[model samples]
Target: MLSPTLITVALAAAMIGALAGVLGTFLVLRGQSLLGDVIAHASLPGVVAGFLISGERGFVPILAGALVSGALAGLSVQLLRRGAGVKSDAALGSVLSLFFALGVVLLTVAQSQGGSAGLTMFLFGQAASVLRADLLPMAVVGGTVLLVLVLLWKEFQLVAFDREAARAQGLPVERLEVLLTLLTAVTIVLGLSLAGVVLMVALLIAPAVAARQWVRGLAPMVWLAALIGALAGSGGAVISAMGQGVATGPVMVLAAVALTALSLLLAPERGLVARWRRQGAARQALRGRQVLAALRGLEGDHATPDYASDEAMLQAYLGTDAGPALARLYRDGLIRPAARLAPEAAARRWELTEAGRLRVEEGGQHA
Candidate 1:
């Protein structure tokens, strides 16, 4: 029984997630994660400019303003990269501060006029503001951005992973980069209406960061990021509905952060816990092999037994020296005590079981 309002918020948030899948890949690959922050800050000026020109606080005009300002912000970054001989860090820092200042000034003037609605929401974001009218442009831009990212997946990866190599192979790295920057700007503009300028920033990049933790390559990362973003979006909407006066934009951001944090701790290959477990498992396997070898030499047994037999021999062969490795091997089923053997040597010879052999050869316990 989702209220229409909740339903709308959830849907929009999910759509936002889908949008982030594309935008995140580009940002991460280009090493421009901070650019999302820069563009978010820059959108203040864009919003004001849109309001100034449109003389009203409509969605289209505000988004248009956002687009222009965002483009300028990106353009400034490029100028720094190519023309000013400045690094991206310096360029983004300078432009972010400068554009934000201008935006603040204009916003002050606009607020002083005192007749607009939803103006301040741009500073933090207000997801509850989403309406049917806002969806059209967002749908168009979000869809287009996603579509382009999919179609140019190879090219984007080329630009992202090895720009020089991609260039050597004659890929249009420069043009594609420009397109990506513009696409980021457009995404910022679309997000502004719902998340506002400052808060929308988080939604832009958090899902992608989360996706990276969960994946090895670009495509999976993009898709995962989008799923994360969408879940956050919908979750935020639902929360805002239940909690009175909750801010939509910030809620969405928090959701993205939660997903990212979860990914860091839980993602299969790259997560902290997962990696630790894998390493531990590997070490265990190595230790098991060593213990078996020690017992094998001690028992004068050279290979005619299963893991269980190996365990039995190990107990007697190494005696007190069978050690922690011997115990672990038996516990993990890599070895066991042989029962049907000579009364004198039944418990003292070691051997590798099928699994034990595989473990020894695999090179990694996790494998």
Candidate 2:
């Protein structure tokens, strides 16, 4: 019970999201995330050129223009770094700003001219403007890109993890690098109508980052990212369909960001809450051991049964929070308050019970 327009928009968005997510994983791992953003921004000028050339927003012309612009931007980053001795980040920034500025100028000029109705849609996307004809091309491009990604998985992994090692292995490192750049261009160009060039980087980065928190392996990460991306895309489309003036691109980016936040807070091993729990447990365990060890040392000094260590002594060894650890130790029966302490001591002292002493002895032996 979905409208055809809704279905078309959802399918196209999902396709674009999957492509961006898969490629974005490699970009993230390679420490070239900014490069993807640069490519996206660079594609704007091409989109403008396409609109001008075709006198309408034809998919093929815009895509071709974007691909060409995206490729040049990718190459410029490398050439700037290698040939001109510029820093990598500086080169990416240069290309991103320069290309985007040019695109903006072109866009402004196109707007001043006639026959540019809804052309600004490429800036932030006009999901409602998508047609059923767009779905097939999106599917074809997305499937082809995925096929290429699967085929070059190993080569991409090698280059991403260690480019020097890949080069040493004679694996055509330069070609792999270029291949990745081209794929990145394709992803950026393909997503222009979904999120637009301006906001497309969020689609590329957020899903991969969210997936990274939940997995350790590259392939699993890619799959998870793709799923998250697809969900974001389809969900955004559905949500936008419910409202009269809802924008799909921002909604999709927000959805991806929501997934990232949830992953950061709830993912089992890498989540913030889980890590805090682990650290708290570890500190509690350490404090318990410290208290036990203090008791053992007191016993070694001939304060075994009658004489107990004072809180002052324990606090000196542990920090100010020793009170909680001491309370826990006593509650656990690992230590007991002394029946009698030296009259000179003002604070209550502690001594290990027989069970506590044996436990400490066993721990020492193991260590």
lDDT (CA) per prediction: 0.76, 0.85
Q: Tens digits of per-residue lDDT for model 2 on 274-362?
A: 99998888878877887788778877887445457788877886666578888888888878887446577578778888878887988
**Window of ten residues with lowest summed lDDT in model 2:** 358-367
Off by over 4 Å in 2: 300-306, 310-323, 330-333, 336-349, 353-367
Assess the local accuracy of residue 254 in candidate 1 as a C-alpha lDDT between 0 and 100.
Answer: 85
Please provide, for model 1 over 231-286, each residue's C-alpha lDDT reduced to its tens digit, 9 standing for 90 to 100: 88888778767788888777878888998899899988899999999888887666
Candidate that scores best on lDDT: 2
lDDT of 2: 0.85
Return the clash pairs for model 2, or none: none
Which run of 10 residues does model 1 get worst, by summed lDDT?
299-308
Q: Model 1: residues >4 Å from true position, as ranges?
A: 285-322, 330-367
